[model samples]
Target: MNESLNELLYRSFDTTLSDEEQQRLDEGLKQSEGLRQEYDRLKTMRRIMAEQPQPDFMPGFADRVLQRLEDGGDASGDAQLFFEALWLSFRRMGTVALLLLIAAISYNIGSSDNVSLRSAFNIPETTMEEIIEPDFYQELESLR
Candidate 1:
């Protein structure tokens, strides 16, 4: 019921009370019956929570939550489900990109017999004379 009593009472639950603080809190507890009941309630709640098993969630759950928040507003029901599904599938998007890269490399290699990187990408070897020929190439076959 004292001004500092409630603060000291709550602090006792979470912190190691110093000799002076512990003395003050003990004095407060002696004077107030309600304070004693609150202390008991908090202690019992902590014990009950400690005995319960921890919970788990599906993967990417946190990411989807943050993504929804980043989009600016809260969503519920069907919209929430749709956003969660989108975040969950994001990992597969990386796989999709990788497959495209491999396909491009394969295409580049398959197009040339030489199999070198430049040939795979179809970059041709050229001379300054060949590049300088604005009107005509050094060879007619070069057109192909």
Candidate 2:
């Protein structure tokens, strides 16, 4: 009647109980049939576990990883292709910009002598000083 069957199971299976506690548990077993049945069930479970062993798994998990690499499933290759397409678009835009800049420069060279009667706002050559550097204009400036 005084027996804690849970405490007895913990003591019998886990080996953490004191001698006085074990003696008290033994006395409790004779006093109560319900406590004795619970204790017997716990003991039977522990005995069955000691008889059967657990299974272990195989160790070649790295083989699957190596097989994936050999099959060209790398994410870096996909990212590289995306970046290459982006770079090609940027290069095409750069070529178009360079062609427009060259055409503007050629037009200015060819249309220099066309004089008009209208007195509109005239943009000074110094405004384009950096676009056409001083050293580049030095030969033409000396002839003036």
**lDDT winner among the candidates?**
1
Highest TM-score among the candidates is held by which one? 1
**Tens digits of per-residue lDDT for model 1, 20-76:** 999988977887898888778878988999999988898999998899798775568
* TM-scores of all predicted structures: 0.37, 0.35
Cα lDDT, all candidates: 0.81, 0.70
User: In candidate 2, residue 58 scores what lDDT?
Assistant: 71
Tell me the number of clashing residue pairs for each predicted model.
Answer: 0, 0
**Model 1 ranges off by over 4 Å:** 57-144
The CA-based lDDT of model 1 is what?
A: 0.81
Give candidate 1's TM-score. Answer: 0.37
